[model samples]
Target chain A: MSNIIRFIIKYNLVFFFLLFEVFSFYLLISYNQHHKETFLKSSGNVTASLLQLSSGFTDYFSLKEANEELSRENAYLRTLLPDNKIDKEIDDIYSIMEDSVEYIYRPAKIINNSVNRLHNYITLNKGERDGINRGDGVISARGVVGVVRYTSQNYSTVLSLLNTQLKISAKLKESNFFGTLEWNGKSYQHAILSEIPAHATVSTGDAVVSSGYSTIFPEGILIGTIQDYELISGEGFYNIRVKLSVDFKNLTYVEAVKKINKKEQLNLENRTLND
Target chain B: MISSLGKYIVNFIIIILAQVLILNNIDFGIYINPFLYLLIILSLPVNISNWLLFTTGFITGLIIDAFTNSIGLHASATVFLCFTRPYILKYFAPRDGYEPGSLPVPSHFGNAWFFKYILIGITAHHFFLFFTEAFTFTDFTTTLSKIVASTIVTSLIIMIAQMFGKRNKRR
Candidate 1:
């Protein structure tokens, strides 16, 4: 027993090293789950605030670019408004008659962003205090950005569309043929659109937009344009490469979409299915 | 001893800031990522015990991981490097071994010895980090490219930093 104790004591450092390594591996495996829960991600208060502080310093350098994007978004939003009194009357009537859930857009700044990882996440300055919640859809002025995965009091973590685990329901604008949009983990500006029927006419530069099958995003939000595509022999689906519209590397501002009546709609759907 | 402790703490904060703010945002193409934060582990005193070395490595890595959302990848890689550090030092040591209270900076150790030491340490670190991040060998070529490119880039940056840092050597 004395000899065994001596042996163990002599190699205690090795044992401690192994223990710490095992603990790290445990964290890696548990946290890298397929669905990768957002509990321990970058939205933690300290890290989030640190990121925001750094961004505050860096945002100054990009003032010109940011101003351009904001004005462009302003011009687009102006076009979306009713330009005539007749259209305004019709829009008011349409909104009142349509007793449906509406998705409200809340603007937020992206404090930290990454595009060079298998699972890229973006940190936004808006959080629970700004009414940003988990599952809110985030988009840029040009197109889709990501989904809000975690939130603290003043910040939120968005699981970017570039992540491998994210799949968005998308459809072609020309044929309305729908498929799933996925990131190939190679390039930040491109994603893969799969499951479109091989027989569907897919040409280069074809527009792909959200199908609204998932309540997270509204219908017809632009995702990308088809860069190229190939149909594998005897396969039912076309393998398509799409050039994403949103420039993720240059993303500074985004809007978190909050659906006001989603819960009620889901409950109603569930009740009808039960009957 | 108290001054040395304060220096290490300050070094820790500086390295973490450089890493999380500037280095993390660097896009040297898709394959290259420069992790200059490993300098924290490399510059520690030669006489520190094995367990303290490992703990410091873990703490440094945990900070980077928390900021980058990489979870345990950095921590595991840094710990592995720490566990292997002593053996590497032993193999490269001169006849009398490393001088006490001396840092592993190139100014004290000479260019050739420092190059070999840091290359090995950084290579081990980048290899473990990229492989763990991929978590699979299915994309063997892609992972290999990343490991090689990043290792070279990180080693070059560390060498440059060491060259400039030679001026600050304490007698």
Candidate 2:
């Protein structure tokens, strides 16, 4: 018994290291599929609220720039509102349908942002209490910014467009051709829009906008313009570089978009896939 | 000197909090996350048992892992560092040998020796971390660049931390 005890004591360090490694390996395997610890995944409600309070104190200096952007967007919308002749023709036909579509915007400030990382996430001031929820779309006046991932009472985290996990459906403004926009984590100023078929007439400065296939964002929200592109040799897809509309480094304010029928649409899709 | 038990507990909490709250947020255009927590392992007393050093390192890293969503990356890297630390220290041991009950801080070893010790240990830690995080040599060039950038930044931060400790001691 004494010999066994001495042997265990002598080799305890190796035993402990192996034990820890085995435990860590188990966690790594589990975390690879899906993170299990929800508590540590994000800051909880209390911490998020504290962050929101802190952001309010810090955001005062940027009010002028935010106001300027808002007024400019207001003026642009006003100009379009007066020229309703084209919209009136479309409304006449759409009036026959029962459901009318409209969108509401919830203004929020960006509390923190990181663009250079492969998996960047942004935090915004608005949260569940302010009508933000997981899967809601967020955008700045410049373009689409990201989608809401987790929300607390007073703050929400966004999976930024620059995150490798994010893939948004975008298309050329002048053509039906579309592709998935993904960040390569190389630069904040550029991203790659892949899977664009070679047959599409893509150019250096073509406009890209949301496809509106998902309820998170409305159709025609400006995403970016292609900066450069190349057709991969022997492949049918084009790797298009896009200049993002939102300057991630200087982003201050954003608007959260809530789609009224998103839950219903998602449920229907899930059921169809199950069949 | 603070008891080893108390020091270990305090260092464990400090490193985990600092890594998660502060260093993890520093993007710096590259993946240059300073794992300053390894300083705890590097600064263990010279007379301490090797087994204790290894245990402390593993625990410190496991706490870090629990916070960052990166499962065992920190744990494995830290364990590797603890394993290599004794060899590195022995290679750099003074001709007269280490002073008894002496800690590994700059005050005991002087700035140059302390700096070298930290640099070697942190390099090993970062190398293991990045390679494991990448888990592939597919982007070998990119991984190599990240390893270099992160090492430079981490070494600078560790030196700055040492300087801060020295300045505080004078105060």
lDDT of 1 by residue, A49-145 (tens): 8888888787676584776477446533523444212223335432532243256567788988888888789998889997789889998779999
Error of 1 at A238 (Å): 0.9
Model 2's chain A TM-score stands at: 0.78
**Scoring each candidate complex against the real one, what DockQ results?**
0.66, 0.35
What TM-score would every model get versus the actual structure? 0.89, 0.79
| Candidate 2 per-residue lDDT over residues A89-165, each given as its tens digit | 33432242113334445777776666655567777767888778888999887899999977777777888998877
lDDT of 2 at A187: 82
Q: Which stretches of candidate 2 lie over 4 Å from their true place?
A: A1-8, A22-32, A35-37, A45-104, B1-27, B35-37, B47-83, B95-100, B167-171
Q: What residue pairs clash in candidate 1, if any at all?
A: none
* DockQ versus reference, model 1: 0.66
